[model samples]
Target: MYASLVRSTVALAALCVAYPIQTQASDPAHESHHGKLGTVHFEVACNEAAQREFNLAMAYYHSFVMEQMKAPLERTLQADGSCGMAHWATALASLDNPFGWPGNVSAKTLADGAELMERARKTGLKTQRERDLVDALAVFFKDTEKLNHAARAKALEAALQDVAARYPDDSEATILYSLVLSANFNPADKQYGNQLKAAKQLEAVFAKEPDHPGVTHYLIHSYDYPPLAAHGLEAARRYSKIAPAAAHAQHMPSHIFTRVGAWAESVASNTASANADGGKTWNSPHAYDYMVYAYLQMGQDRAAHLVRDGALSNPTPPDHFAAAFSYASMPARLALERGDWAAAAKLPLTPAAGAYPWAKYPQAEANNAYARALGAAALRDAEGVSAELARLQALRDRATELKLGYWVEQIGIQTDVVRGFSAARSGDVKAGIAALQAAAAREDASEKHAVTPGPLLPAREVLAKVLLDSGDAAGALREFEAVLSKEPNRLRGMAGAALAAERRDDAAKARDYTGKIARQTARADGGVDGTQLARLSVTR
Candidate 1:
């Protein structure tokens, strides 16, 4: 088995060599920066073919539209095997944690990337800049078992920082450094220290080249935090226009749109993303996920239902990690958002064949478990809740084994929330309340998932529902408000707040909240259903 794997690895490395496209040097006049491609210098073997492919790969990489990079980088290698920097770029794209989370990479991806980097090292880069960047990635690939996640990430960040400084004229380097900084951002930091710093770096580049893919793309990342979301709106609006070919670029604007409660824009953005790649890219599933959410938020039930049904019936082999996660999470999200507890309860626990090995990433598994547990609790099925909690614990164990502390903690929070919801359903109010609150607190401290536009069920939203069920109107209102603060105009959060206010005898507050929902929904196509609106005494 080991020998077979090694042989396959060698075959993959040699595949690029089969399609060499020998060509003349590029015209010097055309070397100047263009609309979105910009002047990206990788200092390869100094051939036109090598430079062209390298720039294409860099363009995709800079925009975080990475899966598309493989072909171009492969071509670069084929054109000039000694264009070692092209190999390094390939490794970076192949190894990227699509979701921007620490410790989220699959073991297979890590090994593949490390193998590619080894090939690049053996081939040897032509420039000091390429060597430095390649060596930095080497740090991440080294002794995977020895260095902890933070230590490895910090080392890579340090290397990227040095590269950025070494090539001050290279906007691509600055963009890359900004990405590292943004990925390392902590949500609990109200100041968003790292994110702000990243924003400054990206914005400085954006000034000189408004259409630069990396500047627009990384700027979105830099301001993705809730506190800085407004700052990202411009990038979000422009990135797709600048790089329409990239599915991820089309979908990126929805990040800010979702944050700011612009459901219409979110829907449009993801729709473009889903279609841009003909629904074939790894980005398609992710685009569908966000599209469903946006449609649901707009109270366009039929649209949301069609989105979910279409994806489930026409299942694809989620070749990308983000696609795998989206495939796993979509059904659960649909059921939970619609308050269809029975449907969620019946969701299959195991991933479908061809799905990205989400089982290797505990967070993806936890999404399904969380939905199941919540569904079971809603149905007052203690046994079902217990079963799901066990599944969650097993997932936590896997994350622990992988040294994925973030996921371990996240799954733990879900477990607690499930247990608490179960307890509250069984009349253990005090313990249930405490546990649920703790879970919410823990979740709030963690960074948001960078892959999806937003989580289907924020922990605070769940806690608020629990409080409302227990008749703790004031407590429910507090939780709902917290959710709204982060996700303005969220449908369920708005409804919950209105309901809680009514229960608390705040008639004026209830009117205000319900009116907001009505106004928001009115702007949506066909508006919200009259019955769901009637539930909160909100009318068209």
Candidate 2:
């Protein structure tokens, strides 16, 4: 009996070892910490008295929840300049945010960040951990001539892994490491093994500390892919509440919501996110972009119009990376998503200042060209279509030159789609169908980025519409089905499917698809218009 009790105790201890809970080392009230457990430490560079302010800055940096962290880090500096860790934290915060995406790191900011890192190194850290942190960052900052961003990121990842291993009790280290792991993943890779590994680490941490900002924030990123998006819904739902003051925090939840086609939840999340920082922060534009997309998906035309109109009329233009992306994409989304040919034709060619560095990239510039191509095709302006197609080809070449592999591929797909539309409009129906078929195949192989709404409408959806117009009912049905498989219950996909079914005289399938769309539309706040439904021959 005693041996049995000992065995049970050993089992329990093993379980405890596997999932270690963070605990207060001393008085929680005075600890230099952020997060739920207060495990974050800033004593490496400062005395206990000033640790409070440093902890506050560390908390924000750890979560990647803010649109900008310079203000908080500057506050930390004000509280204690000798705090080498604060300087280190500032440099870390200024780095191009994870996910290989654009952030607000301008040329001046990059120069300042390098200077700050040098300052941190010279200040001389107190703890081995502090020294180690600086040493890891030095790989990224000290020698930019030798090490590229990709090499530096990988080196930082290795260093963080070592940090987490050295201090298993430090949940902050583990969570940070997990974030880098997730961010370094190739966005186009469908296997998702790296993301899955990161998710497991974060999920275990989340189980113990549900309110840890990093845990919730990274979990949402881990599952941002469409295949994995639903798994992040709970985190998405909780993140905004956990970090209510963070504009990006409120917006992050909608990533999962948009993936799952939960329009109402998406609308609510983006609305809150956009307003969280008085709608002035860089994150607000992202929120507005998502909100408008959600509103349109729900058939809330008025609400979508309100959001778009408000964005265009706003006197202040966003200058940072996040806001710039939103600024460039919002109007393009408005024109393409609604099939507003006139608006598309008139879209401004000049990009805003916020999108400065990346504005010229094909990925960012493709939207305007896409709008022009569609508008020209709809108007049967063959010359206009030819010009847009040429522009797309040039953009593809530029993407290749820049080593933007993903954008190169994406622009190629766009070129094909544009060419297809141009061919069809010019009365070369067969060539158009073939070009759209190739475009759909390429699109199907690629995963959409989390930032934009549904690829300006899926290529397959467009292909199906074109086929239906060409009287290829069976071909149209196949393409529409492909879209519905990937995006279930989508209004456009379902409507196309129903129309294709009716064309084929498959009354039962047509009735079933029409019934599903009706039921789905009925649940929305404002039902889809009867005339729009009639145009597709899926009458109410």
Query: Which number leads on lDDT?
Result: 1
How much lDDT does candidate 1 score? 0.73
How accurate locally, in lDDT, is each candidate?
Answer: 0.73, 0.69
Q: Give TM-scores for every candidate, taking all chains together and pairing residue i with residue i.
A: 0.86, 0.84
**How good is model 2 by TM-score?**
0.84
Q: What lDDT does candidate 1 reach at residue 395? A: 88
Clashes of each: 0, 0
Off by over 4 Å in 2: 1-45, 62-68, 100-111, 349-362, 394-403, 523-540
Model 2 C-alpha lDDT per residue in residues 396-443, reported as the tens digit of each score: 787676556666787788778887876876789999888888898889
Evaluated at residue 289, the lDDT of candidate 2 is: 79
How many angstroms is residue 391 displaced in model 1 relative to the true structure, after the best TM-score fit?
1.1
Q: What would the per-residue lDDT of candidate 1 be over residues 142-180, giving only the tens digit for each residue?
A: 776787667777777788898899989977778778887
RMSD of each: 9.8, 11.6
